[model samples]
Target: MNKKILGLVVSPGEAEKKVNTLIDMIPCALKEVSQNTEEWQVQTIVDSLTGSAESINEIFQKINAHTKKNAWDVTIGITDLPIFHEGKVVNADINEKNDVILISLPSLGWKLKKNVIKQLIIKMALTISESDNDSNNKRSPSFINIFPRNYKSVRLKIKETDSFHTRFILGSKIKGYMRILTGMTFINNPLNMLQTLSGVLAIGFTTGAFCMAFTTMWQLSYLFNGWRLLLASVSSILGMLAWITVSHNLWEVPSKKNRKKFRKLYNLTTLSTLMSSILIFYFILFLLFLLLSVTLLPPSFLGQTLGIKEGIGFTRYLDMHGLLLL
Candidate 1:
C-alpha cells in the first residue's frame, strides 16, 4: 500500500469544494522539495467525522496509532478546525515535546522543518447561500476561511521568527502532541452590549424631537387656538439644540469607550423627555416652535394679527400682568 498523508479540516458546518482545492494544492507544493527528504506521496484524503475539536483529535490519534504500529512513514496534517469558546476565537497550536509539525509549503519549506501550522485560509474559495443561485465558480465565496465570528484559531510562536505576532506553522517534535493557546482571540476589542443599547436610545430621542416639532407647528396650536404656540416653538428649538449640542456631540466621538459613555447619558435624557405627560410635552414642544418662528416672523404681522410687539397676544399678556398684581 502507498504511504498516505492525511489533511483534516474542522469547520463550522458542512464541508465544501474549497476544502477539496486546499487538499489538491498540498501535493503540488510538497513535490518541489529536494529528493533527500522523504519522497512523500499523498495517498488517501478524508474529511473528518464531525465539526468538533474532539472529533479532529480522535481522527488524528487513530491515524497516528495506525501509522505508528505499521511504521508506514505516513505524514498527517490537521487544519482549518474551528474551535469556539466564549465569544472570541482562541488560537491554539499543536506541538509535541520539541518536535514541531511542519507547514509543508514549497515556499516556506525552511519554516516547516519543525513547526505545525494549523491550516488557515483567511479568504474563502466558495460560499453559496440558499437565496443566491450564482452557479458560476467566480461568484462563490472563499475557498479558505476560518469562520465568521470570533471562533477557533491556532496560536504559536517561534523564538527566532521575525513576525512572531503573525500566524505560522511548526513541525511535529519529541513524541506525543502538544497544544498551545495564548488566550488571545480577537484582533479588535469585543463590542459591549451596552453600546448597542445606547444606539437604540439616541434613535428614539431624534424621532421624538421631529414628531413633536411637526405637531406643535402644524396641528396642536391651530386646532386649540392656544397661546402655547410660543411655548411650542421654544421647546422645539431647545430640543433641536439639545440634540445637536448634547446628543449629536456625544455620539460622534472616535473612541468607542467615550462614545459608549455619552450614549448612555443621552439615553437617559431621552427617556426622561418621553416619560413626561403627553399633553404637557405637546405644549412644551409647541412653545419651542413658536419661539423659533418669531425670530423670522415679522413684528408688524404679529401686531396686526395678534395685537402684540412680538407674537404674544395682548389679552393674555395683560391678564398675566394683572394676575401678578393680584
Candidate 2:
C-alpha cells in the first residue's frame, strides 16, 4: 500500500514556517530511512490552534480523526500550545495505533529548536515505520541523545496488546523548569517590547534628556558608587516588571483544575518574560541616558559639581559615572 503522510501545523509564525519547510524534506528523508517501494506522498494542513483540545487525549483524538478522514497513514502535528501528560510538560506524543505524532513547540524550547524538532520528527517517522520495537534490541542511539542524557523517553502501553504509546518529556523537575521557562520566554518574545512599549520608551527618553541639563542629576550620577548604581538598576527593572504584571493582570491565578507545580511554572514563565522585557527596556534607556549625559553635561560644570579638577580627572569621572542611575 502507498504510504501517505500529513503535516498539520496548528500555530502561525514559527510553527507554520518550520513545519512547512520540514514537510518538503520528509518524503525524501523517509525514503532514505525506511526505503519503502510504495509511492510516498505528503500533504500539509495549516490551521489555528485548537482551543478545544484541553488534554493530550483530546489532541490525539483530533489528530487521529483528521488523519483518518484524509486517508493518510501517518499525520505529524506541530502546535505551539503546551501539552501535558501525567503532570509533566509533554514535548512530543506518539500514538502507536493511530500513527500520529503531536509535538508541543513550546516544550521544545527556543535553544536548538529547529534541529531538535527535525530530529524528533525523523526519529518518530522511523519508529512508526517499524525500524525498532518494544524490546531492548535495535534502538536508535541518536534518538536517545535528542533529549539530555538524564532525560528519558518513557513509553506506556495504551492497549492490552503489544503496541505502546510513547511520550518525550523532561523527567527531572529542575530540567523541566528550565525547559518550560525558555520555551515560554521564546513564545512571549522579548523582542516585541520594541513595539509594545513605545510609549514608555518615549516618555522615559524625553524626561531623561531634560534631566541631563541639570547639575543635580550630574552630581548625583557622579556621587553614585558602582554598587549603588547596580542596586538602582535592579530596583528600577523590578519595579517596572511588577507594575506591568500587576496592571496588565498577566499573573496566572491558579484554578482548582490547575496542577500546583504547573501553575508555578506558568507564573514563573510570566515573571521571566516580564523580567527579560524590562531589562531590554532598561538597556535602551541606559543608552539614551548615556548619550544625553555625555553630550549635554559640560566639563567645567560637571567638574565643579563632582568636586574634581578639570581635564583627565573630570573626563574620567564623567565617563565612569556615565552609568545610568535609578
Candidate 3:
C-alpha cells in the first residue's frame, strides 16, 4: 500500500508566510523519513483553513475529520493559534489511529526562524509516524517508558522548556550552530533586530562605564598609592554585580521563583562576557594608540607625554605603566 501525507495550514492570511515555509519543507522532511521504504509515495497539499478551536483536543478532532474526509493517510496541520494541553503550552500534538498531527506555531516563539521551525515540524512528523524510533532509543529507558502505548498520542513543548535537553544531547556542536543560525535569521526581522541592537547597546554602555571607571582609577594611581587603585577596582566590580542583580530581577518573571538560580547563572555568564569584552576593547585601543605613537610621535614628544623622568628610559617608562593603560 502507498503512504500519503497531507500537509495543511490552519491559519489566517496573516500567517501565510509560515504556511509557505511548511509547504516547502515538509516534503523534504518526509523524503528523508522514507529513504528506507521506496514503496511509500509521499505527496503534500497546503491551504489556509482557519479554525475557531481553542483546545488541542478540539483542534486535533477538527483536523482528523478533515483528513478523513479528504482521504489523507497522514495529515499534518500547522496553525498560528496557541495550543494547550493540561494547562501548558504545546508545540505539537499527535493522534496515532487518526493519523493526524497538529502543530501550534505560536508555541515556537514570536521570533520565527525558518530552519528551526522546519526542523521542529519534521521532528513532529517523524514522531507521529513512529520513524523517530532510532532517535528515541538514544534516550534513557526511563523516559521511553513514559510514552503512551504504541505512541498513540504525543505532546511537545518546544520553547522555554527543559524537556528538549532530556530527549537530546543539549551540548551538541551541531545544535549550537543551528541555534546560532536561528538567532541570526530571527534577528533579520525588524522587531527582533531592534531588540538585539538594544541588548547590544545596553551591554556596551555598561561595559564602557566599567572601563571608564577602571581608566579613572588607573589615572589616579599615578598620583596616589597602588592600594587606592586596588580599592577602586573592587568597588567597580561590586557596582557591576549590583547592577546585574538589579537588572536581572527587574526583567525576570516574578511568578517563577525557581528562576532565581538560572538568573544568577545568566548574570555570572553576562558578567564574565562583559569583563572579557571590555578588556579586549581596552587592549585594542592601547595597541592602536601605541602604533600611532611609535609611527607618528617624536621620541622627545613621547618622553614628555609619557612623563619620563630625566634619567628614566623610555622603555622603562613604557614597562612601568604604559602597558597597564591597556
User: Who wins the TM-score comparison?
Assistant: 2
Off by over 4 Å in 3: 1-3, 22-25, 36-53, 131-326
Please list the residue runs of candidate 2 whose C-alpha ends up more than 4 Å from where it truly belongs after superposition: 1-3, 21-23, 31-41, 47-54, 83-89, 131-141, 158-163, 296-301, 310-325
The TM-scores of all predictions, comma-separated, are 0.25, 0.81, 0.38
- Candidate lDDT (C-alpha), each: 0.32, 0.67, 0.46
Scanning candidate 3 in windows of ten residues, the lowest lDDT window is 142-151
What is the number of residue pairs that collide in model 1?
A: 47
1 or 2: which has the higher TM-score? 2
TM-score, structure 2 vs. true: 0.81
On residues 1-326, what C-alpha lDDT tens digit does candidate 1 reach at each position? 22234333332221223344455554444433222232334333343423233223443444444445444332333333332222222233232221112211211211222112223321110011111224442322221232222222334443432222212222231110112221011101112222433554355445544543342322322343334544554575467446544754533434433344334433433333332322243344335444444454444553445444455454433322222111
Weakest 10 consecutive residues of candidate 1 by summed lDDT: 181-190
RMSD (Cα, Å) of model 2: 4.0
* Model 3 agreement with the true structure over 263-316: per-residue lDDT tens digits: 443344344444444444444444644454455545564445547556334443
Q: After superposition, how far is residue 205 of candidate 3 from its true place, in Å?
A: 29
lDDT of model 1 at residue 133?
A: 29
